[model samples]
Target: MLAFPRPASSAFYRPDIDGLRAIAVLSVIAYHIGVPGLPGGFVGVDIFFVLSGFLISGLLRQELLATGSLGFAAFFARRIRRLGPALMLVTLVTLLAGYMVLLPDAANTLGREARAVVTLSANHHFMKHAFDYFNTATDLKPLLHTWSLAVEEQYYLLWPLLMLGAYRAGGGEKALRPTLLAVLLLSFAACLSLSYSDMPKAFYLMPARAWEFAAGGLLAWLPLRHSRSAWHANALAGGGLAILLCSIVLLDEHSMVFPGWVVLLPVCGTLLVLAAGGLDPHHAPGRLLGSRWFTALGLLSYSWYLWHQPLLALGRYYDVGQRDLLRDFLLGGVLALFLAWLTYCLVEQPVRQRRWRCFATDKSTLWAGLAMSVLVWLVASAAMYMPKKYPWPGYQAILQVKQDQAQLPPGCDMPERGVPLSPQASCRIGPAHAPLQLLAWGDSHTDHAMPMYQLLAQAQGVGILRRAYHGCPPLVDAVPVGEGKVRSWCLNHSRAVMAELASLSRSGLHGVLMNVRWNGYTALPVAGSASITGLAQADAQGNVAVAGAMLAGVGQLDRAHSLQVMAASLDRVASQLAALRLKLVLLAPEPEMPLSVPECLARRGAAACHASRADVDRQRAAILPILQQVASRHANVRVWDPIARFCDAQTCYAAAAGVVRYQDQNHLTASMSRTLQADFAPLFSWARQP
Candidate 1:
């Protein structure tokens, strides 16, 4: 076989490598599209991670050993020459598709993703938004999977210099082994530690990812550094293959903390196979992975990886709320094959052959790619984040304090709080004298609802006092985000909200308005990522008992018990509002779409969340039982149901006379809330309070 020109060597194209690529690609596809019977399929990407480290490090290491001072510029030029053309073509098409098909918010999200993609920081973005992996807020984000590419790029940026520095600073190739081993061990240990403690961190962070790549690096460097017997290589290959097979077939969903320690199985497996390359073709395990068909897929693997995620994400994007695992998998495979063919022809072959060598050699050319990518990233970021303008000018400073506790209280166990207060964070409602003061509070549920509350308050003399805790629910029934540590915060915040309510009730204040979209106490976000064998729903026996106890606790707070607390609060606020009668109203939160808004918005046609009156009726009926019960218990509470006011026989919608009602489900646009006030504010005209 003639040595084909790979940067590392003029070596013949390895066929079985494609087989490994096929294995990796298929596994990731199966895993992501929610195909049954392959829960561990995500490990396929781990396979790619290992392979990439080995190949990239192999090339770099070979050059370093062959030449004293590495040709870093040529090395980078070759990478850009090889990977850039295909990547740019794909990204441009994806961005174009984003502009057309995506919803406004989805477009914003894709814009952010575009920014992250161009900047190569998608891993960090995903990690920050990791808490709600598929929250209603982010379910339709098409570029979510680009985190892997970010990881690869991150590894590429750091690893080359580290290897080069190690080679130069120490005993060259001979001393390189221990340095790599130590770094690998440290990274692997970090992964192991995070896996046991923080699942999300382990899943996304770079430290946790280093070992897999290092395992590959070590494998690539091994054979040249030391000689091993044919029997040793064969046994290594066979054992490694067995480990890989066992992991895919035998492992279940129970051990999801993978690519941490569990990744060793496959990384070691690949290592064994590569190490065995010095053997005869008939050598058992070596021959299998090295087979002609396997190598073909390996050859096309880069194109395949580029093709698969977009196909799968797009398929899910189109499907929206509906999950069709099998169909998505099938479509994913077909689209991948199609894309891989196109990429191989249009990008991979031409670029790899340096047909456009003129651009590759010119520093200005690479600089152009970088400059364009950065400019696009900046523009996309600007598009995604439109700064919020406060309706009331002076309130901006008050609302600007970023709320850390922006979600639900952890376990909702506070026994001390009698009246309920939403754990809503810093909110600047209308001036202290605003006759109508509406309070929006909860977890981020509270945070997201603030715009609607503000619009309503501004028009209705309703002052909006915003307080939201992240992961802390407004409901005493709401559980903490994860486990025990959160329970204390949940209890304390609930206690605070309850105490605030008691004080307000006694202050003779204008009606207190409250809003929270309390579904998760009974419902989970629609994404399949959140799985529970027996999540206690609202009507669940255990949940009902808990709710009953919570109500009983609130009911126990009589005027006599709250007198001292209320008097102190009244004294403090008397000068602020000066003896104005306080009215309490429970704002009936609009119903959310059964699916995420992006998922709903991504709908091309009428099945989009244009919830007809019938749909509102059904939703209201489902949650009415809980909503009314809560409202009924509160003293002097009035219902501000958007359904009753906004829906008129046919549909509850954005076209509510001169106002665009919804930015998305369950949240009203600022303008819509103001418009609705035109109709509803007169109802508050009867109030004698401030």
Candidate 2:
């Protein structure tokens, strides 16, 4: 057996650990800032989890081995000193920034999140509110990054107690090894299970995350034997680092369910590096990690993590230039580094090092920490309720847009589960006595475009039947499955709706106005839980599993494959409708804005509240071709492009005539949708006649 060096017994600073810290923080920053070729940069938080477990467990193990007991108060005091001051400082600054730059709704959110940060409950708060960490909307939240810190703190609260219990259970430090191993196994099992079942719980809760810490804690107890050669140690550390690099390269936000099976790569990698270096800091990995630059960045990692997100998010919120994302992040990074240095030097170093005798002891540190936390909490509470009192310029206009944003009238859209295809009285959009001539079919996009349909129905004196299942596109064989909670209902609803199309045609329904967000269905699938509308292919016997093939154990279909599947489905559906003498009018996709129009207007005002026409065109480049090809194939099928109505040559304006045009990123507001009657007149006239 190759002898691996045992860790040194005596306590000493490990520069290599600092280097590792530097790597973790930088990876996170790079990921958040949209750094290219580093989509898996989020794995940095998992790395931090392991590092914290190892260091904290090692410290407790050392104390138990020497003194046979733990000093709970002293440990917590040290932690408070290390974490509290810098957090309070950042929260205060973020709060002031919120007050100055944000609208009432956004300011209130910042205030609420600020309280959660100071109270160390940010993980729970964000878990409830922010469903997906990778969601684009979450990029606007400055305090969102604090959830990881909350997880670490929550783990520390229970970990030392477990260590103390294990120490008292006999066999001295050896007892801790088994206890940590048990925790590692059990917590990992729970994490794996919940990642599939309840992702938010798995992601944000400490229980599901405890295994990562336990893996690090187990590293602290690994028995080491001194070896003559360093080659094996170098190989082990190199292999570990190679694994981490692979993870960073291969994984992304939607690559896999986060902190699931894939997380083991980073956890194992971190363990390998720490295991090899803990015994001898002279190993190749150690020497590289302990270099001056790595150590310096490591020293500033905590403060940098705290400062960067707020600066970036606030910068985005206040930005009017609509500059390139890379440029925005680059500028934000410089500002964040400067602020982090000031925070580290002015607040973190002074408090943690106990520069004055009065603040030197554990008691003083705890009291000061408590006072600071209270101050933050009070200020956050004030900011929460104070937003309405201080209105910004054009606040009333923004407020009206916020209050009166468009939605499909109640009872019109399908519920999450089960197929409810029957239309109610409210679902018909025309004079009650007028004959129902048209079917408005699609997903949420159709729901958003209802006002235009309603206006046309009333003007043309024809009833339009509204049939919309949220997230389920208008397709026959392509069923939406995987990821979202609504998938089950979507499949059932889609199947039922498609099956009823012939019945509708027999009952005098003449045309189908199909308008869905085509980009979502056609986008390439990554290796994650992002559900897509999949094409169900049949086996040899002409047998098809409406719920089986493509959805069972299959992730989303790739972009080209998905588009192919959708085009085939559209062809079949259009052909079927054409044979039934039903006119098929395919509404070309509306330009999707980069952000919520109302939210953008409230924050950046009217001048800056629009998306680049070039960017919109780029987004739709893949979608338009398939739609055009599908529409051109059938005599009765035609495509209607509304790009000219909503957009000029240069821009797709979010608001027009001081009214917000979009309710969110893609969906049009009722006011804006109503203004599109001129655009929809020809289609409505044709459908009514047919």
Candidate 3:
């Protein structure tokens, strides 16, 4: 245990610290509003955490040294008075605004977040939601910023008790310092470990973040004599500010390692600033921080933090394209400042100053805080369950139609690697005892057609094996590129499905239906190396004679040649299946809508819920020619066009007969798939024959 000299008073008012607060809050606001220069402005939260730990620990240490005891009730009462009123006001206003602007699903999510905020469990809630703090979607969440406040509150809830225990156990402040240092080291280690494996845990949990606070607390507990040399103070503060500015400018959302070792930059910088100011108030850095503008901004910082997010979120909600982003951000900032001033003067100051006699006593303040929390929770709950009335008639029915889309059938399952594909039975639809007549192979597009296939199989007394992997194309040689790298799982799954198809073909499977989102394979770059266009260009330049060698037997090709070889691989597979006397049918791409069917119908009327035929034709042109060329080379292969079922001369219907055709933008709803039975009758009729 280390010993230290106690300071004169627990509460030391520092205008410089308030200026630091102004810097912290402004950086956060600038980052949230998408300011161009400060991509890493989120480090402001780290500054706040350090400041909080220093102030609170210093106050507690002084009380213990002066009174030789802790007043738990009085301390909690002060916290409630300071935090409760402003929090409740912001939450109420945000909730009301959210109800008016947000969709039903988004509104329901807000209500759940509100409940979590009231109980100081918002961090846990957001973690469960798998929220990425730096993602674009986070901008729409009005209460997302409250997670930091929750972390601070949760820390305060238990930190004082722990300090009191340590004070009694060790008999002085000296003994507590080493214990806090050990805890800080351990927490930082945890943060590093979890950040790599489980980012949400490291990002949102208090334990992983406790080291930052403990760093501040340990600084407060240490004995530091005021530096008589003004040069030392100036250098320390100036260097700290420089580090903070660099962190704000250099990092971004795309940086993989964050809130880990990288966080040391901002945390250490903040510590330096605090230390320098504590040592010399009249130093160059200290004098600048204590200036009038910085001090006033610091006074309003708390309220400003509370108001900024909601205003920005609402602004984004109303302005879809964010036309003139700079103007919108400026307007939002101005509104936030106005609201922050109002709340600070009207609510925060009054409550903290005990202007309301009802909350004059500690017990009364606690009760009042709890009562307000309960009222907010009730309002949030009401908002969540409030009857949602859509502007368009029959919208409820369209939603119901989407909901009725069946899940993956009982015997059909696609588990991740190392898991059994299916447990109780084979991936077969129709009669259990019947022989396998048809095999559906592709990606999720095949999964979407399962209900229709099941109906067809039962009517024709034929067993169908549904073998599909989500997002894995049926092509033998191609791999998916996601997040700028080849998806190994997609490659592995494709090989596995192709092996299964070969085995099933040898067992006398009558036919195979290849159903995939063909456009995805053609347009998306393959394995992050080359796209279909690049492949075609290579062939055109005589670098890789893909078209000339279309009928050549399979051979080992360079990895860069994989995407270019996909069309040839499809033709080769078709030829092999044809040799085995099995039929091959390729389902043409469906007309994908630009937006979800429900969103389109609700935003625009049902009469406007159709896509232009020319757009669909243009999008499918590249893939259609490839499919046609493959079919032309094999006698057993045939192409099935579903466009005639949905499109007229100039338009493709998204909804018909009062039913939505799509569950989302691209996939067909089960209800809509079932309605395609007439078009599918011929395939079943062909299978039913001897």
TM-score of each model, paired residue for residue: 0.69, 0.75, 0.72
Scanning candidate 2 in windows of ten residues, the lowest lDDT window is: 1-10
lDDT of each: 0.55, 0.76, 0.74
Candidate numbers sorted by lDDT from highest down: 2, 3, 1
What local lDDT does model 3 show for residue 668?
Answer: 88
Q: Over the stretch 1-690, how does candidate 1's per-residue lDDT look in tens digits?
A: 122212223354444455567777767666666776766666777788888887887888888878865776676666666666676666666666555454345557777777887778888887765432323233355667678778877877787788878888896887677777877899888887765555456667777888888888887777543234557656866776677667666655443444446767777766666555534333566567666566556666677667666666655665654557676657567777667767776667766665655554547447746765776776576555532321223323212222211232234322333225423332455545674334444554455545445555555555555555544444433333321012335445644655565565464334444455433333323223231111111221212222111211122122222222222322232222223344444455574544433234434433455566776676555445544554455434455665666666887653345443444445544444545454545434433244
What's model 1's overall lDDT? Answer: 0.55
Give per-residue CA lDDT, model 3, range 385-416, as digits (tens).
Answer: 66254412344654565575746656566666
Question: Between prediction 1 and prediction 2, which has the larger TM-score?
Answer: 2
Off by over 4 Å in 3: 1-11, 314-332, 388-690
The predicted structure with the larger TM-score, 1 or 3, is 3
Q: Please, what are the lDDT tens digits per residue for candidate 2 over residues 1-690?
A: 112212223457788888888889888888888888999988989889999988988888888889999998899888988888888888999998888777788899999999998889999998877766776556678899999999999989998888888888756876888888888889999998877666667888999999999898888878765446797678778888888888777787564676678889999999988877855568888899888888777878888899888887877776521335665576457778777777777777777668855359988877887888899999999888787787565567656665564445567656656466655576777888988889888888887878888888888888888888766777656654333222455556666776676787787788988888876665433111133434443233323344212322244455666667778888888888888889988888888776567767766676666778998888778778877887788888888899998789999888878557886667787788888889789877887565
Clashes of 3: 0
Question: Is candidate 1 or 3 superior in lDDT?
Answer: 3
